[model samples]
Target chain A: MDINGPVESTVIEERPGRRRLPPQERRQQIIDGAVAFFAEVGFDGKTRDLAKRLGVTQSLLFNYFATKDELIEAVYEQVYLNRLAPDWPDRLTDRSTPLRDRLLAFYTEYSTLIFQYEWMRIFMSSGLSGAELNRRYLKHLGDVILRPLLGEIEFAARSGGTPTMEDIWNLHGGIVYIGIRQHIYRTPCPDDPSVAITRAVDRFLLAFGVEQG
Target chain B: MDINGPVESTVIEERPGRRRLPPQERRQQIIDGAVAFFAEVGFDGKTRDLAKRLGVTQSLLFNYFATKDELIEAVYEQVYLNRLAPDWPDRLTDRSTPLRDRLLAFYTEYSTLIFQYEWMRIFMSSGLSGAELNRRYLKHLGDVILRPLLGEIEFAARSGGTPTMEDIWNLHGGIVYIGIRQHIYRTPCPDDPSVAITRAVDRFLLAFGVEQG
Candidate 1:
């Protein structure tokens, strides 16, 4: 919850007069430390070092997380997977609103979440590790987000209907690519992200031959 | 260079009877090892571990490269910067070539070079490290490649003129995103990269109101 500097592992140790945290709180503490540590040192960072950061012994760290893989998964869950909006799938399919409005709304929220320094760094760390997490995460995005949006665009466009999967990826991937250039690779963009998102969505609509009133 | 497994640090050790490589060859060997090692474990990987992998003493490692930052710079040179085709900017602006043809020609070669497992992995690792290398690399891409292409597109389109910087980045970033999804994130992409590149170029041309006769 504290989005400050790296979680200090020495906090508990420094305060010799303090009582031990409840198990759930302690677990959350370890996860916080892991996120900051992994972001700083990367995923191949040592478990012993992580325990040291947490001011806990390696054995205690292992007791909470059976393995490094488990701890990494917790990072993915905390940072990547669980950030998805609970109602995104429903909003993505909501036919009452025009498809464009829903898209702009969804991406605005999604980008705001993903474009942070912490999120992008950890996401890149997991990716560079050759882990399956990113693949699985992108597939989830395709299934829950992209494919359904494709279906909606088809319904809305009517005569222009059923854009090829290639087009679908190009359109959607273009927006995500924008975030990556800015957030991950730190390319300077002339437009604000909101402006960039709007332009990207407009470009996609044009490229797909979706007519606007 | 052996394109297989992480460049083994034990390469010299494994060849017990082989004579030592000359100084230049030795530096190149260390650079190669750093590329492979950093690509696998990221830039935060320990110098001592890299020395162990290289079958060299830590002192020897430092002698060749004064610091880890210098080693990382060597990696950016070898894996990222040096891969840029020298004539690419010229090719991008050669007016005799049709705009679409020129665009496709450049990206196909660029993607083929950059989409390698090592290239993408090291790229993502550098970006994750919060180092300025990726930003500098992306800026080079924008300056040398994207901005020049935008000028050519404007000249070719004449009356329609150029689109905004937002559009240029969207078009260029869209194609690079495909590479990131496939090579770095391991997303399943059924189209060969060349096919995908062609499609992206076609869509960009269409979106920017560039006519292809």
Candidate 2:
């Protein structure tokens, strides 16, 4: 059972001999194509279009991506920039900054990136929660920063207990989900001018004992 | 100049018989049908299907919705529950429990509704942000919540202590923009594990001074 791209439709399935490129190049092609496509057409955006962008047969495309899911995973891997996290392990040693400000730096940078790549929300909302690629991507996130950042993230999740990988995951998702609704979904809200991301961070920090003022 | 549902293409028109039914009933009918259609078929779902569900013809669908824009407005009206927030000015003063608990209640209820109507994200991620429906809906929100909560929200905007309506609107859009990224775009973090709504709330709270542990 090989993972695939776009689930039902793989463009390059039959074009095995179309070209010979480095694995890195081919993978980048798929990632670049998927991001641009999603940015424009969103989740329902097609794979054939990606083939068109690459100027190759659908089979050749399939040879690289296998399925849209695979392609999306590749896109997630390529585009996500977690290496940029404000040194969660040691940034706060500078006790001069308020705890809230330090937390905001981490959050603002993360949310800014997320907000900048608007199509990222569409990718997650595409009912692909069950996909192996998405799961792996999430697993990577857990391994990278969350397991070690309990004390820091405590200001966000609101509970002092060491958060499990899943708790951390859900906490982040909860923030992103509501943010999508308020901003992307254009859902209404009270005079509370805070965006979903800001709101999530606000609650998260409060949960962790960050002073609201 | 005519906008009709783009069941197959970019949606551009509305249901044809809007004026035939009484205004309230007609509005309700269209809202119910549109929400169902978006939920069942997603952003690309057919408006014809919505009419069929209502036991109406494709052309008759235009009666209730004159253009695709009109129908989307109906969907926004139903799905965007922010208008309901001001019903509880008491929200700001609810000491029955901690502010955290009250806010969690607000965030949970709001996030749950969005989750159930997953299309809420799709409808937004469609990149049809420039539509009149979107503007009208936001204006309505200002009327219901922002106008009344203007003073507090203005201060929240950090707008130099005195701001105008446009300033508040800009700040609000920024926050909502975050929601769009996390929930609608579903950007994955390296550490996130599950797809819960609390994370969104926490982020929202952090953006403002509402939540504190």
Candidate 3:
């Protein structure tokens, strides 16, 4: 059966010329399109529609992704995993820089990546759909990002008591909420989130009995 | 054409002998079921499926709610608007209580209402689907809840600077993220969030140079 019949009239035919591209470039293009498409519609969107939007035949689209799940997996990697800076863990725990400056810098970079319309919508969509994407990303965030920050806070504290994981998550959540407000809730947020991020980080350090250096 | 035909076999026939409920009671029942249903399947779910789940005929479901949008509006009222305590604003700005204590009390009560699985999931689903429900509720929340709390903070600040809406949003978002982690991310959170709430409120006050009296 021809699942991809005539293209829907609503879909704009952007690729009228249909210029041939290299295999790797074509694969990257599909993944980028999938990220935007899945963000607009939830993951439940049909592959036929995606093919139509991409101006590709369903069979050709299937050449790269055999299943919708495979396509979604690629979207997950491009949208979520690839955005995590590898050296973020290292930079977060660098004792030479004050924890305050490190936090500001890290969140500045992190927010720039995750605060996009597509990223925020996809994250919310996955969570609502009960997909494993959010669970996995959050787990990775805890292990790679929050855990290292927690260790830094524990090292920096002037008082004897150790900081808990919840403390680190609170600071992270506070910073991330700025993006959530902008993209998810569609509310007014600061044009630049550094001000809010700085306040949250400073308050977190103060609560931990760490004086600003 | 009857939209709802025979009951699906997969749906457990709990109401073998449907006991007739009074008009108001039946309306409440449908709204309650809808809150759960939409939270699970999202607002895009069909009325036929909702009737099947509720063990009611589609005609019966339509009697109370003329259209799916109407039903969704009712669900919005039940799940979102009804949860806001009217006196919360008054209590938050009572001034008799210390700002820290007031914040702790407000969030403790606020989280209790919003931290439930149904509430969290529905909130997320609505936001992702681009429904007006979240935007409206958040606006109401800003006016009725956050505005009062912001006024209280500004009143209590020992320093000259007045707190911005972003400041209050950060504190609220940090406290609310505990629930989002539990319900949205399906992660373990503190059994009692009050401890975390207390810590957050104290830190917020500390940032403003308000002594914890």
Which candidate leads the pack in DockQ? Answer: 3
Candidates' C-alpha lDDT: 0.77, 0.53, 0.83
Error of 1 at A110 (Å): 1.8
Alpha carbon lDDT of residue B202, candidate 2? 40
Per-residue CA lDDT of model 3 for B29-122, tens digit only, reads 9999999998888888888898888888878998999988999989978877678888888888888877778777788888898899899988
User: For residues B51-93, could you state the per-residue lDDT of candidate 1 as single tens digits?
Assistant: 8888887778788888878888888888865777789999888
lDDT of 2 by residue, A1-213 (tens): 444556745454654545778978876776777777665555566778777777766677677777877777666565554534546546643345665576466565665555443445444544333334444555555555555555455534444443444445544544444444454545543334234445444445554555654
Fraction of the true interface contacts (Cα pairs closer than 8 Å across chains) found in each model: 0.62, 0.08, 0.57
Please give, as one word, the docking class of candidate 1: acceptable
Error of 1 at B189 (Å): 2.1
Native-to-model Cα distance after best TM-score fit, residue A114 in candidate 2, in Å: 2.4
Q: Write down the C-alpha DockQ for each prediction.
A: 0.47, 0.07, 0.53
Tell me how far the alpha carbon of residue A209 in candidate 2 is from the true structure, in angstroms, after superposition: 7.0
Share of reference contacts kept by candidate 2: 0.08
Candidate 2, TM-score vs. the true structure? 0.50
Residue clash pairs of candidate 3: none
Write model 1 residue lDDT over A39-116, tens digit each, in one string: 777787899999887877778888888888898889888887577677999998998887888888998898888877
- Candidate 3 runs further than 4 Å off: A1-24, A57-64, A159-162, B1-20, B46-48, B57-64
